[model samples]
Target: MITFNRVRSSILKAKDHRRQLLGIHETDVLRASIAEAPHFRALLSEIQAEAERARREPAPELSFTDFHLFAAQGTRIEYEKPYFERRGRLLALALEAWLHPEQKDLDALQNEIWMLCNEYSWALPAHLPYTLEGVASSRVTMPEVVDLFASETAHALAETLYLLEGRLNPWVVHRVREEIERRIFRPMFDTPNTFPWESSTNNWSAVCGGAVGMAALLLVDDRERLAGMTDRVIRAMGSFLEGYEDDGCCAEGVGYWNYGFGYYVYFAEMLYEFTNGKLNLLQGDKIRRIASFPAAVALTAPLYVNFSDCSETYVPNTGLVSRLHRRLGQPVPEMTAVPSLHADHCYRFPHTVRNLLWTDASLLHQPAAEGTFTFPDTAWIIDKHRLAGGLFAFAAKGGHNDEPHNHNDLGHFILHAAGETLLSDLGAGVYTRDYFREGRYTYLHNASEGHSVPLINGLPQAADREHEAAVLKQEVAPDSRLVYSLDLTGAYPKNSGLRSYIRTFEWSGQAEREEAHLRVNDSFTFAEAVNGVEEFFISLQRPILSPGSVTWRGQTGEVKLTYDADTFSAEAEVIESLDHGSHPLTVHRLRLRAGRVPGEASWSFLFTARAL
Candidate 1:
């Protein structure tokens, strides 16, 4: 029952120690570079000027509502106040130190720097012990607090503090470090809680947590502590890699796929610098494919069939790709045709979408070939466009409901068609209050509706039969067209009598076109003969821009099938609006429920399409 107030108070009270611990004598690491490298000097000056402009502007007041809006949009707009202001100051001080290493009078700049850091520390009181209650109604537990506060805001602050050490109080750095370590790192490793950190199910825990750990190593000087921290980080990374089947698709949607993958790259870059390339993550074949995942999803028009909690507003992260290219010692490619946003400072590689798309052409042209497949816990895609193409992919389930940015879609799959995604999984939605974590929001993610499974008894598929239990059984097989299977019989209550649901996606790979037959079989044996079993449906949806058609063929049962392609266009219909100008490509939901209690029931659909 960690309250926001409690966390905030703890953070504030810890400030005194932070100031003392970070009080190291200043040393100008970048001093020689300023004079030796003109580009570095210019960049530093530019950063300082920007910081000055921010300082001159009046601080704007923002409410929790404003924060929610920015979070959802993935924009840091509200940072014009405290968070960004502090970051700007830190950048200025660091640049100033680089540009004027011998300056005897840095008093003014140092004062402003401390003021910003202290102000950030003060503001934590308002948002501490982060809780959904501030946004929702109920008081969440301590683990939830950790999840809420380990946000983009917190990450930004931690990064800024790490980057601008020495200019601010040593104690400030130590305090911020301790707060994050206790609230985020400790709980992540020591506790059984399943936010992003505990679940090795995906790469995000490794990436994001890895980045934080790198920051910690950068700021903390104790050799023993650093070794321990690095060991933990390596283990976490190992967990993420374990989730990577030789293929590369993350069970989490592409959006999370990007988030976790991006963090992996981020941490990898830091690890490269810290270890002088001795411990390179890019060396791994499975890990390297993660870099190209965005390209696979981008091959389809409008990018992906973001059926889960995904929106079209998300564009490719070209900057990340550019960074990867450099890290791997490749030439930076021309990228401008792809839709993208400007790269932020925190990102390791800051190229525009155009750059990545253009460079990724190499990946697309390599060849649509198939190769030896490895079945990790999940089936994922590594080189989706090569010999592996659609042949390589993974599927698995079992992430904590308490995981950061979790959806109730444990058994869902992301399918690639002829090197492009014909039927794909939707990623996450905007992080607004309305969309925060409500699993029942049909359009929010690849939950029950967004997936290829049947919903029995009209109840959402719970991971566990009991509210506190974990998922029943999630398994996959790569040898046959029966590529994967998931049995959620345990998700139901007791004596629901062998109530079992299984989904098998069989794929037939051909040069010109690929076929995917989705078979969902369910058996429910009630103690007493049940009455009217009415509501049921089979749904197959793709993003609007998908250049293929999906026809549903009924296999068994006497259920009426309806087609609502939401679009009037000959090609596809636009149904839901995700952003200002973007609409979710159309969704074709098929429903089949028991008209009356028949003894048992089953349903299936065969989805076939040609590569666009």
Candidate 2:
């Protein structure tokens, strides 16, 4: 275990104690580091073929016209997608050449880097110079933009220089270094107020700060300047921590947790390595609890709490989870060994590099965690069980409608059986300029109606911090069961006459048989009678709707939902959302509507999914 104390002692006892560097001190060491990795050489042919394909490709060019398009029209996919696609090729070829000199493609690497330097700005066209209203603004001084992609690009350039300094052209090297100073260092250290991301409390803070800090460590040799940068970074990281509640619940959902918090770990590891144990940011009660978040949300394998604009199935990042476990002793969430090297995204470069560099290969042998966990601060519950037939899991959340990356999904829940999503959350909608700038909540996934919650008076849930849920109580039993209740009065409009909505979930698993059951009881009270109340339970399978029950069958087996006929009526609609362009998915919105009536109502349902 690489504990803080051991690292500190090792640093003190070392002969030289020079700042640690990856494959930079010696070429042989670099070669060995790559050679020992099982993936390095095996991925060589794959990277080379990718390089050949990239060489044959036309270089992507972004003009002021592309920049102006987003400003004029809310269309980001046209320019941003191609822009990122181009970056993917550049990074892949560059890393390939540096990692293997025996089959190096120096010309390709240099060509890509030169083109990268020539781009108008590493920042996305949308992020170039814009007001909060999404209109393009004039930049008089150094651009104060610190976006996710731009920051990572800076670090990638700096780290590339650090590794292949002598091989690169002197003039090109000078240009890259000068650009880094002008674009990032000066704007960050000399005039930080010009940059807005430093104080951000979301993924922006961790990602932007981490990327800039990596560049500082790789390029800035002056201790005082480096110290100043680290100081500002510490401040920004505090804001990132503050973004989560005491429950360590990531309101951005686990996807951004993998994104925002992932960068937090990436940079934290880099700092620890550079400082030689003097600064171990991983040592803290909050950090440890924060590290345990994935375990709390993991339902069997890929399924998770897709609260906000997250996906129904979140792929596990094994390298990151392993590193977190080693550092904080958090259990490794269920994960498969998938290579993260060649993923094509701007935010992926720094992380992919670090994933290859920092991961502990031994953690791959660890088994997926099995248990039940709850976070009371955010009112999230996850229960995973290894039953007689297969895996039985369930997860849900009741938080504010106005969380970062939030959907108005208060009192939302998900049920999984045998690695199958029986009850689902549609996660995110397709990304468009309108998705962010226009009516975000107007979309089904962004609206309260998109989740497994009540559609009171045929109205969706409202947005903002004031709309939230109160966790009344919770219980996790040793008999393989969990129960929790939430009061969702503030999740809707006051005029909706929502006095209090108490939604309870009780999950129980059978040890001797291959069966798991959940009882959802919704007891609601209103100040005045309204049109009607419709309860929604979104599912991937087409539910057979009836008078007071619905059922769905899939690979996981049959899931039968039986409710009170006197209180509600059931209906199913096939809702198709095109948020993920090529992979436009569909869901069955099983609605249970109550007739317009009195001030109080009670809805009860028993959900059981059995494995055969």
Candidate 3:
């Protein structure tokens, strides 16, 4: 479980060390920008309207409401915790207090706010507490509440606070600087782990912890500590980056990519801002390339197979795209709604329609696609469309188990055919409750059934020793053949005789025919205690259709497709039994496993044709 003391100590030390090394003071760049932005001006107007509504409306009668009871036993609250929900409501009231000082019930509002806070304090474990209210409230204060509430919450809250007030809050400035110093300078210093909440590669521990360290540097108050923390966070981020093959696929699925990749972008943005454009996170081009992740899902329409936990069928957050656009210094034409906690006000149809319109408009202007590029451990091939045609993209992973959101899927690729995605990678699932952490459905996040290579043993690559693994080498040949060499040979330490493993994806495409070729190769060293094995599997999915003949080539999985207009049907899958029953929705997953683990093995999938 994560501990507050560890987090507090690390943050404090980093802050102190930063002060000694940077010889600088807090600078309020983000705070001032937020105050002045046109977007913020619009947001303020919205807040004022809500405040007016709350005032004109009769105040609800107060009672000794059992906040915990509401969270635990209440049928409505049982589905979702009331702690964060009530906190959001309370923060809204507080904002009303801040905006309209003339309200005679200022004391009442403050009292109610404190009561809500106290309730959260009681609901959460001692280590975690409520920090900030929500968007309308102060971002800086939220981090404090997070830190005070729980270690994980604190880390997340700290990151947001660091972004909002590194220059404004003396406490934050000092704390960040101090923590950096302790973690960086102290030889034995280690970062805090998620307590109460188990530490996972996809959770608040790795992603949020890394963000906190990166944000510390922006305050300009703790140079020494910031340097140390920066070193650790960057290395961690680097390790995560190395895990992706060129295709920009994440094994934890789209949900995890959002969690892990979201923070990755957050930290990169902080670094870019703090360095005054000196250290560009986009310099490596790896993070920017991840843009394809959202693009992949977006391009695959109708089915919108975002299968996992309780995640929405369609993503509600477009703010991320907007943020990315800002980072890339380009306009994100199609953005509908930003993620929100409030269910009632969250989904905006206008924004959604606008995004769809923008997508259609952008597709009209085809830009010349570029060549394949290789990052530390990944390879990417972009099929840009200058006109209206298929845009095929591929990402091959060659990184280690230690990569952030790393999964066992090393050779996953997402395919965009015609104007739609024929083969795709499912994004993410829901985050509320323990859904994001535990649940056997967690296997949904493993590499086996994901859009990549699956090991027969059903063990995840980063299931153990998650932080230290790495991709020792990777190579992408001019012939479009991609090879990834990993050190996971030692992933199963109990079977130590395992030496090395290699996964290769060779891609060949005929631009004129819109057909592509995929060749997969796996090589592994045998361990005395364990038998070597190999498996070849591929998952092919198209939007829900009826009575369709899904044909494939016997040699290299070749496909010739034809759809009857009369047989077309649009249906969705309901999670009842294990298989789809006569429903219009159908998903076909084929697995070919070889019990023998050869020192070297190869398999291939060739796409020779396409049918709309």
Candidate 4:
């Protein structure tokens, strides 16, 4: 319902209003305050250190050889490493120059900006489309194929120009504006649907739309033209919100919630400021629910509900969280520490700058409420309690296999005790061309084999919306025990002869001891006698296996699982792989097998976690 006329009418008539959005004109005041701010000292020091390093080192060269590597070799690391490094350097240089504005820093920042403007395309090669002809043959031109980073690059340059207009050389400022108009604005306005992300219900839509809209808000002067562009971005942002149901459960997990929603908030704030708070995009009940998602999913301070393609832990953007808390009066998880400027390899400009502008130290003092929360719309349940020993938590998901950053995992659960996620969700896998293509499920993290779920007749769960788990029961007892059950038959292939598969979980705290216990009962009924059934439980800690019990020792605690030795054989396997960061990762898989089971079979497992 956001139209061009609505957008145009909302804009303030004051010429200098845009410049005052984030107090961009008050650089001297910011620099003075930032130098003295205790919380920002570490951030300022890191930025200064990185700026010094960048001044000495040559900017990472992005050559044709590196650009073509993704197309030819099907690997992303080779090109992306240096590509992101250059941007990281760019971000450092810009921030330092803005804060200090010394002749040396200004010179370095100007050179960095010019070099970025000269690049053929702002988008990464991996993000570019490979048509039927091939990547080499595809006409991936600038402005025509605007991706997330392309739009972000435009926003960065626009902000830089706005921040250092008088100081920067006239030529550099002119070139930056021209490139933004050519690369982002014209393509976005002229040829709609040139990029699929415009209508995508994921991070791409928010990041691309938000970044583009922010740049236009900063730079565009013509209100009518700006309104048209803003309308498109508003609609794209709507689609991104649509991806989440009313429950505000982010299907892609917390990492992407940080990414996609972060951008949405970035643009929303800018729009609100531009319109003098007349148009507030962050006003609705759904947005408040979405804003509270990170706190709801956190197992502890850092560990989160890493259900889909997400890392086990991530440093939240404190500025974004603080702003949300201030605006919506929603509870955000307390951030023990702020992320370093170099935390993001991509070196996003908005996140870095806003961290300086919006982060409130007082917000960290508000304590978050702890208890059980269930999202029936998404089939996600989470329970956490602070026992005498430590924090104990459990999270389970029963949504369809086809989700944002989809993993073929249903009826998967995670158990946390003390500070460790004993039974862990093997978060995200490495990214290669094939990692997203047909070979996606071959990666352990994306496959059901990597999750804590049962295999029916030696077959893993199928991938699609149709192949989904059905929640049969969810209830809480007066004694604070939680009981949840799911029908997981639809998760398997029809050929697997899975007539019915029920998984029920019962979690309760021990009355006499500072410990927690979880009992999982799995009942299976096949159309015929099944060949075998194997239950796979994944953990980061090495597991010790006995005849009937398996134990995983953590840094501060241990989780021991007990099953019937007569019915199931237990064994453990060490898996070596790469994590989402492409770092070497090791996981232990505890497999409990029931051989040659009858048409109907049932198994139970009791897991006990105690502080060491």
**Tens digits of per-residue lDDT for model 1 on 32-80?**
5334543233344455675455456543443556445444543333443
| Model 4 CA deviation exceeding 4 Å by range | 12-15, 23-28, 102-105, 131-143, 192-194, 365-368
Better of 1 and 2 by TM-score: 2
Candidate with best TM-score: 4
Give the CA lDDT, 0 to 100, for residue 95 in model 1: 46
Tens digits of lDDT, candidate 3, 1-612: 113344334444432333312112332443344346543454445545654554455434323343223333322233124344333344344443433434555443334333432332321322222222332453222223222123222232233233233222354335434543332223212435322212333434436444454435544354445555665555556555654555565544455565567656656655554544444456545555665554543322222223222121344234445556555643332233322223222211112211221122222222323345444533222332211244443444443343444344444454444434444444332222332234423544333354345443544333433423346445556764454444445444443345665555455555655565444445565544344343323334432322433343322223433333232222322221121111132334433344444444443334333433
* Cα lDDT, model 1, residue 367: 23
How many residue pairs clash in all the candidates, one count each?
51, 1, 58, 0
What lDDT does candidate 4 reach at residue 598? 93
RMSD of each: 11.1, 3.8, 11.8, 1.8
TM-score for each of the candidates: 0.54, 0.91, 0.49, 0.96
- Name the lDDT value of residue 298 in candidate 2: 70
- Across 39-126, the per-residue lDDT of candidate 2 in tens digits comes to 4454455556767787887777776676668767766666776677666776677667677666544776677778877776677766
Which candidate gets the maximum lDDT versus the true structure?
4
lDDT of 4 by residue, 440-523 (tens): 999999999999997888799989889999999999978878999999999999988889999999998664788999999999
After TM-score superposition, the amount by which residue 273's alpha carbon in candidate 2 deviates from its true location, in angstroms, is 1.9
Candidate number with the higher TM-score (1 or 4): 4
10 residues in a row with least lDDT, candidate 3: 574-583
